[model samples]
Target: MTQTGWTAGRSARALASLALCASVVTACGSASAAGRPVVLSYYNEPDSSPATQDAANACSAASHGAYRIVYNKLPSAADLQRQQLVRRLAAHDSSIDIMGLDVTWEAEFSEAGWILPWTGSEAQQVEADTLPGPLQTAMWNGKLVAVPQSSNTELLWYRSDLVPNPPATWGQMIADAVQLAKEGKPHYIEIQGAQYEGLTVWFNSLVASAGGSILNANSTAPSMGAPALKAMQIMSQLAHSPAADPSLSVQQEDQNRLAMEGGTAAFEINYPFVYPSMKSDNPALFKNFKWTTYPQVSTSLPLHSTLGGIDLTVSSYSKHAALARQAVLCLRDPANQLEAAVKGGLPPTLTSLYQNPAPEFVAMYPFYKDILQQLTTAAVRPKTPEYQAVSIYISHTLSPPGSISPASNLSSLTGQIRDALDQKGLIP
Candidate 1:
């Protein structure tokens, strides 16, 4: 687990952000006039899955005039969404009663005192039947700051026609790709190698699978020693191979999906969304597409793919806290989660949803078993308020995977992370 202590006080950047927030915060109506349903403004990313909107509608109706859960859609990009919420929360805007926070944002929002911690029976209710990985991300400093809504992890997707069996380890996968390349076949291994959070997720997954972590136990310094270096060497090896994508350094998840669908690649490490996308966009290729657990760094160690998801949180600035909290619980109820899984391709956070899942869910996620197993042991990124800066620095050092010089780059990365943690680094 990553440490998320925030007692060192705000950095200059945070202070400047707060100052900016004070300057441009907008005004909105009160929670309610009186006797009117309290307008619980639920701010979230656009509802890619109908489940999000369905939950909001369902909860509002269930409130029975107590509150109306208004679905306020934010921008698509994660960073853009965070910027909007942070500015509003910093200025103590009461308009936002509930927020759908990205898992990484939970620690930052909680540490900044922008989100309320769940306690008493509410906390227990949130904890009940939640999968460990998603639930872990919903917490900060040993407190539940949010409720897990939807969760996701990557699976090793492959062209079954190209490879009768999936590779169990990274080395084996690379070797198989190389052999296929020699035969003039579509052999590229698709992965997220772009200089962004995706790159951080990639490296974090590799390090964890190699039995190491990016930060020390306390999250104050680097803990990436030999294991991280070994992980880096594998990245370098893949980058140098002919089986690697030529645009590897620039590829993100969508690009990887496109590459595989375009038939230039035989393998992909991506989320469940690709399964549905492939079926819709390329039926022929989708016919041979198969998935398995994420590749291992070592046969001796268990695979640990990084976790991705959203959490439902109540804003500290909300005037309708009581209503918002009630809505949060309802929004993540099993029915809504199932809809999100079957319709939106998102995995549910509730563990019970996976055991003998709905037939519709099974149809969408034939590899649900792999997803459940990997998520049970999924690795979270560093849990400090400085996670964004740390990710920027690490990605800066590791971008263009082919350029990775294991030993020296590892040392340089260690120094950069330390600077980021100390709040003195310039990532760019």
Candidate 2:
């Protein structure tokens, strides 16, 4: 059996034994009264900062002996993290009290009844206080299923020293890149074009910026048509352009960042993490780094950068559901959010935190306003239970973007997306 399968089986047996022991008021029940606090397990991706751990410690202390949180580190890769959570939740593992979920996983988890829904005052507070785009990520089927902690949006990073006036549109940017290349300058435009989640994000942003969406309002069918074709054509042209990265087909976000830091790329579309990563890796390169809202597809259209980030979700099977909810609120409190932003370099989800950022945040103030603007106007990916399969089909079909021709591939892309959503030929 798979590791997750083995874990689920073991958890089931343990829970069954605990249930029997509780019935007789024996060891299991006595352990609770014998100075054993109600332990809550929080599963999340690995983080280098102690900010999250510190916050958990603070919350545990504030619980007044009610509960303590035990951190469970998941794999850094998002797909792996989802796989681990899905297997355990599918088996109704009650030990999973709280979880850190990717924004795109919210719909899938909620639809599968893997997460607990937030309602009443908590829902009202989350809706009122968080940025609209990030808050939307926590909702599935018009109900809140998670609470956003930090939010991320892509920015167009450019070397201000090389290109003083960055291009405002994709056409302009490509033209400038081509000109720079002609001059024998080591400058190219870096983007995530690999057949992965990053490619889905880039495609969604491009389509949205062109005044279209990947799916219809209800996510029941493909809404991509002319706008999508236009976006794909743009992507194809850039991939084959003189200024295109040679390894664009396999490049992800980190590769894009590395290219920019190596001084080979004049512009890149990447998340906020790139800022701090650049600062620490090569201070000299960081000096020339600047960011702005993603370039528009056309002058008449507004940029709709894709939203990315994590959300704190409560497990449906958690034994201490109330305690888990309380811990979530504590973890997302304004003070904790600010601490995370300053110490961990994570952008805060609270809208007000951006308005009056802490001193550390202000030090990197050049990108602050643009970051907030992008977050406010961010475009979300398709919100559907079948989003994972849809993303896979979209990304795989568009791989090696250089060879894609919108006229020939649009229909196939749309059909495959629909088939994936319906589970027509895809493995269940």
Candidate 3:
């Protein structure tokens, strides 16, 4: 595998700074030196329920007085969570024992040595338990850098009562949507077209569904070619079509969901949370809703849903690395994952959970099989330390999708992606 010079230089600088911080704190020698119990601080984005806290409490009790787990909540936004963690880790804050990481962050965090690597029996167990796509997200440069705790993927949500059979391809969906619009029902399709992470996700899935990727196999350069152009062409056409939501350029996932629930759109692509949320907010609409695998870009190609969710990692700067690892393992236990799914609406990474879902998850059993299948086939965005830059380039360049022309913009898009990967024009 080839390493980028930019990443290497940054990693060296980060390590040097960490060394200085370590000297001041005696390298955070131990979690505890005296008889007092060691405290392990876990930092993660806040969850809606106390499932994570409950698991931490259970693990602490199970540790037999060895350590106590302290929860530190980060901002809800993924970017903010990453920013906060990066600042602390760069400073060598040993208090960050464990961290809840976004799946896309595994590559960056592992490459920069901000998180610990998993090996041996533990690695084998995690690999064996997690579904393939989610498991792959925790790996970086051929090593397991984290453990998949919960996993998510997009699904094609449709008004089943109106259209009994969902379309199999994007072309078909668009055609049906156009027909619906002509019938005086506008906004037939709801999608995340805003210039944000959601747009990147949508593009990733579209490219993958067309049997292409944003980067080559090694992930060191841009690989957006014909397939990518085709994906963009489809997106452009949809945005300019009569069936599109007028606010397409500004629509986020929540707005799309609300549009669908408000009886404005006939179809949407969103995460599983919408299922339960709709069930609670509008039972009548929820009853009419149904979901299936994300629509394929072509009839011959299989659909590729975009992956999302969290991973658990032991912070490389943690003083209590060993105990933190144990705590992470406990927190990711299948039982705890099941509880998180039941109470927090987070999907379990464990394959067994899909085979035999817990009672709490049974309420959505109608969609579980399809959800699990989509998770297994999900496509991940570029796994690079420069992913933030890449995402920004793609989202910004393709904003107000109607303005994009595959024929004229493909080369420019590829150039921009390469620039981002090379750290050119980066904000630092």
Candidate 4:
């Protein structure tokens, strides 16, 4: 029940004076939301857990009747959520006042001018004391377009009962898994291998960890050179080895988590959510469930595990933009961020939360030290206005990892991305 202790910031103070009259003063009680407290519709992915609704409730109470944040749950899929938000925003609909955006959507939404960027003191407040990696995702063309609500990064989860020491390098991991396979033990290495956003994340991590990026600094075209080839070689090696899951081409995060918990996998690359799930579903296996830093592509190079999570933004078309912004601040404040972290398994974006975690937080995240270390070097996916299109191109080229010809596949990817950037390639 302890607080995460992040300052509520200038946005909360500025918003307090508007409690008497709603931000939409003239439109108050004019339409479907006829009441003293203006209804702020918050569209986000469905969270069966109390994290989302609870944050909404806390923020509404803190508003002192200035606004009521109604949680409108969207589809669970990332692409579907983006589609819904894009369609509504394109129509200039005011129904969606706030949205929970995927980290990768900041650039696209900001470029489209669908979401308002936080400026002045509010922007300073949001940026302060936040983890640099998560904060990086909220910036677009030098504007803080969104506030990071929570963040996530993958780790190498292994069974300690079988392996005495965790593999530090990808080559070592594959060699270990292959040997276990020969001994007829649980040796499958689980990862996100499906032709979707997960595949893009995997490829991005590999390239970034090897000191290369999928796109140049400007994110206009492919930068797949030596580092990319190294990443491709690693991906192909795993896919062609005995350590790969039988359903590697079709597996996503949940599938990878399930394989690890099903006792058929000796290793898994996934997020911390798998920690609690394993404890609940298979206590015996959970006893041996342990985690380490993500296996790296090179011993000399630092890992750049892909970052994932939700960010909160005020819709540009909202009638009550000020109130929406203020409520968003409260929704992601320390108290609520801690709630989401301790209960929902989502990590807080604030640096202090990891530096000085409370008892409840520590109980849920005993490995916070490792997580923080990784977060310090975490990398975001390709930052571009055409991120979705680029993701599609990268995912399709690297799908069905078992068939990857690193050199050939990389060349095809380079050409597709170039044409797409010049508007000569189709999205589908």
Candidate 5:
């Protein structure tokens, strides 16, 4: 089985056991919140396994017997966490006292009133500490609804030995790949272009590189135009190109392993988690690999990468909001952040914590500091309640090559999105 698949199986068994234990503990009529600690459950990605554990431990120490942590390790399904939240909301809307939300879900969860709003001192602190992309992502109609715990910035992972210098433009990237193909080396580039979230990431990156915004700044209309169409055309060309080694089936992790371990692709676009496995996966291969910022397309305007990250939030129905808030504060503390970074190589969210990362983290992921700067320039998807459906529109429209002509179809899609906004009274 794939590592992703294996992780999912293990998590299913673990959650089942935890559920039984939790039911037993609840059935025994545990002490009231006034006497016992306020407990909150959070769902997290498998890549964040160590971060969740370290964060929970830190929260426990900071809470000093005032709170406890419950983690739900999510499966590998594309929307597993989102679907789980909806299922939990249906059964008990307030059951999840504390939650973790992906930047993309800010709109849907906030609109559904599934997230609790931040207010007073905590609101100011969270806003002051968070990275702009994630901070903005956690907001809904100008209200701070969640705390950005950390951010995931996309970067280019390449075989330094294979391609000494990264390509500077889309044309250059293609040329580099073509050169590698001619040399009888493996494929040159591995991009996440599947029909899932990965596709959205690639799409956002391309649009940003082309100086096009995915959604209108006003958040009421699809902003796709000429630049966006150009980006789509670039992707279609890659998909249809005979010399291209990558297919539509590749995801981020798959691409990472293929480049880093299999020694096939010369470069892969992925997040920081892949760094941890490089040495163990193939020490010789890892020795020659390097991670760096996304190549500059238009240096005058920052090249945008899609923001992928998680935040800590409280359930709207939780009776433990006060306690959950306290725990969140603890999780955001610099000391805890440092500890988590040391334990898991999870990037620290607080700017101050960037001064000194773990030696191992620094050694394994030498591009850490550079990536921090890149994270600031990353872009979040449309931050409106209709974001999920909007994302669906984006994926469906862009997934297939030659499925629809971008120039014509995108105009029609824009009209359809504008109508959607008008129907909801967001725009005319």
Candidate 6:
């Protein structure tokens, strides 16, 4: 193992200190345990991998022997479903006191009352200091229902050697790609086009950067027609460029990485989780690579990237809701969060931790200072039950072989979303 500032022994000592400090101080109010072991069902993404087991151990220890964790790591879309969430809740009423949910599921989970609102003062303090994008995600309508465990946002990853100064416009992106290709290097740009969650995020950033909104004002009418067509034109141009396949486009980040590290491509738009592996996969190739905030459409604005991460919430029916809440507090503690970040590749949600990371954190990733700045500018997707359907429809239709024209598909998707908003009485 490459040496890092943190190790199991150091983490244990730090956590032990936190446990002692927390044990003497009584909770503001004694939350009812309701007579059961607190279970935390987590729908973990791959970015938070490896440390999943360790995180469970830390939460268990920090809870002061108040809860037992039931951890779940579902790696794909099939694993994230309403039925699965419902089934788990039905199986054991007292169990699953806490859950780690996706950003998009915040509204659905809150509306269903699957998770109780996060109301403690300690939680509020955390939320108060949170960056806008992530804070918005933790809320449903006006209610603060969840707290971000560790959030991630996309950024531009490019070869510093090939292009010391990255492109700042769509025109520049194409010109640079052509220049790089002419120089006997690979293509210049890479993005997710797959018919999955990644596609929704990439598309959202593209449209937003073009100064377009998906849902209409009041979120009650179709608003995506023209902007989407414009966005599609940009993507279609990039697709036909020498770097990408005109006949087929890889729709995921993994493929993007292959193109990037193999020197098959000069640029990649991806997340920080890919950093460690990139270094391991080809140390020489990425030794001078750069991961920075994406260039904006205009010189003055920051490129808007979507916030993608999970939140920890409590089950309303959990027999051990109080203990579950405490478990969340334990996980959010600076020491534990920092440790998790170093070991798990989780970006710290706590601003203090993000600003002044532990030594281990700094050693694990030197570019965290840059990463934190980009994350602060991240934007949250609309949090409504309709968002899921909107995202799925947009992703499916934009990818080739779907019958709808880009403009037509976008118009129809927004219409369906508006109908959902009206159904919820969010708009008249």
The lDDT for every candidate, in the order shown, is: 0.89, 0.87, 0.86, 0.89, 0.71, 0.68
For 59-170, candidate 1 gives per-residue lDDT tens digits of 8888787887878889999999999999988898988999999988887899899998999999998898999999888878889999999999999999999999899999
How does residue 164 of candidate 1 score in lDDT? 95
lDDT of 6 by residue, 1-428 (tens): 32244367557756775675577555412422332335455445444455666666777866665575656655456335455666876565655566777788888778777886766695676586676777778887677888788778877778888888877766677778888888887665777877777877877776766677676544445466665676666766676677563323445878777767777677788888678878899898778677777655555545677777777788777776776677776766676667668887777777787676677888776778766776677656766666666676667666752233556666656666666666642322
lDDT of 5 by residue, 248-347 (tens): 4544556656555777777777777667677777888878878778765555656777787677788888887888888877776776666656565556
Candidate 2 yields a Cα-based lDDT of 0.87
Off by over 4 Å in 2: 1-36
Q: Which is better, 4 or 6, measured by lDDT?
A: 4
Tell me the tens digit of each residue's lDDT in model 2 across 355-384. 877777787445888888888898999998
Looking at model 5, residue 22 earns an lDDT score of 79
Candidates 1 and 2, the one with greater lDDT? 1
- Worst-scoring 10-residue span by lDDT in model 3: 27-36
User: Each candidate's TM vs. the true structure?
Assistant: 0.91, 0.90, 0.90, 0.91, 0.84, 0.81
For residues 105-193, write the lDDT of model 4, one tens digit per residue.
Answer: 99989988998779998898899978988999999888899999999999999999877799998999999999999999999999999
- Order the candidates by TM-score, highest first: 4, 1, 2, 3, 5, 6
Ranking by lDDT: 4, 1, 2, 3, 5, 6
Go through the candidates in order and give the clash count of each: 0, 0, 0, 0, 0, 1
> All candidates: CA RMSD in angstroms?
10.6, 5.8, 9.7, 7.0, 7.2, 7.9
TM-score, candidate number 2: 0.90
Which segments of candidate 5 are over 4 A away from where they belong? 1-34, 46-50, 90-92, 249-252, 339-345, 358-360, 401-404, 419-428
lDDT per residue for candidate 3 within 1-428, as digits (tens), equals 22377479658856875676577676444422442468898988797799988888888888888888877889999999999999988998877999999989988898888987899988888898789889889989899999999888888899877778899999989998988877776446889999899999999999998899999988889998888999999999898888789899999989998888888889998888888878888899888888888899988888788899999999898988988888888989988888888888788899999887876678755678887888898898799988988888889888888889887778887988898888887532
Candidate 4 vs. true structure, TM-score? 0.91
**Residue 324, model 5: Cα distance from true site in angstroms:** 0.7
